[model samples]
Target: MSRVLVVEDESAIAELISINLRHAGYEVTIAATSDQAQFEVDRVLPDLVVLDWMLPGQSGLALAKRWRSTARTRELPVIMLTARAEEADKIAGLDAGADDYLVKPFSTNELLARIRAVLRRKAPEALDALVDVGGLKLDPATRRVTRDDREVRIGPTEFRLLHFFMTHPERVHSRAQLLDRVWGDHVFIEERTVDVHVKRLREALEPVNCARMIETVRGAGYRLTQQVQALSN
Candidate 1:
């Protein structure tokens, strides 16, 4: 059974989450404070965390930041719950390392849907351990990249960046979107950092002659194209 930790300072809110999670056949643990939540996380690493944005003593954002900094919990899935529904607040939550965000007054059905989506995305799947698009082939299991069967070595961060692009091919992604999708929403890295990773990814692809696969759209952001565009002579 999947285990979930619901970290909310409000008792009623916590009960609501616990009840729904139990109804969904999940083992639920409740933590009313950030410190207790951390302790629970240490004692029993949950499959996912449903964290409130606001909490006494330490806020949910702080807890999410802490989790991202710790090696053990860095990859843990988190869905942030917040009463703040403004765009800025959502961005802030995402920037703090949340995998997803739930605004206040959100329906139980939507909350459950978000939880399932996050878990599904994180779950291991039986896929082609290696996916080839254009000349680039990426192995999800080994995290190895190859071009035309020639092995290419890339840093962990760059590998993740490339993997995300390959899996989500043809879609133009803003730096913020890429950051949230590839680096987890709770990461506090600057949006400009995405540019740095893209540069490194391009450099790695240069030797393989696949560097043109990553396209930058002026005024927009970046995308990975399967069809290699021919340059005019």
Candidate 2:
């Protein structure tokens, strides 16, 4: 059974979510504050976290940022719940590294679906096994990437972006497609944000001279090429 952490300040809402998740055959843990949530996360790493935007002490956005900075919970999927329905609020949540966002008064079915999707993406699967493109190797199990015989250190987002490109090599993918495939469909982020991460990914690959592997298609999108190009003399 997948383990989930529910971080909400309201005792009633927390209990409601916990009971519903438990009924859905998931192991659930509830924390009423950011400090408690962090402690629970350290004690037992959850497959997914349902975080409330408003908390007593530290806000959920701050907690999410903390998780992104911590190596152990960096890649852990998080779903942010907030009463704020503005586009700015959604963008802020996504920018803070939330895997998904849910506004208040959300349906139980929708919440359950979001939880399942996030957990499915995070769950260890065969697709996450080692993948090799040309001489480059990406091992999701070890969260390591290597070119030839050398190891490469990449940021969490960059790693996911590279994995997506490698798995779908030779095909042009639009920014929207990349966002859906990598950031999850439930995540609301600017399409331009994809450009930012692509730049970061290229920077990570620069030391290995593999930066050119990601090709920009002008107005279209991006493509991953394994064929080496000749240097202009």
**Index of the highest-lDDT prediction:** 2
lDDT of 1 by residue, 1-233 (tens): 56799999989988998999899888899999999999998765777899999999999999999999975577789999999999999999999999999988788889889989998887654144466666578998887898767888799999888987875555577898888877997577998999999999999988888788898978778988755634310
TM-score leader: 2
Cα lDDT tens digits, model 2, 19-89, are 99999999889999999999998765677899999999999999999999975577778999999999999
Number of backbone clashes in candidate 2: 0
* Per-model lDDT: 0.84, 0.85
RMSD of 2: 16.0
Q: How well does candidate 2 score on lDDT at residue 33? A: 96
Candidate 2: where is the Cα deviation over 4 Å?
Answer: 124-233
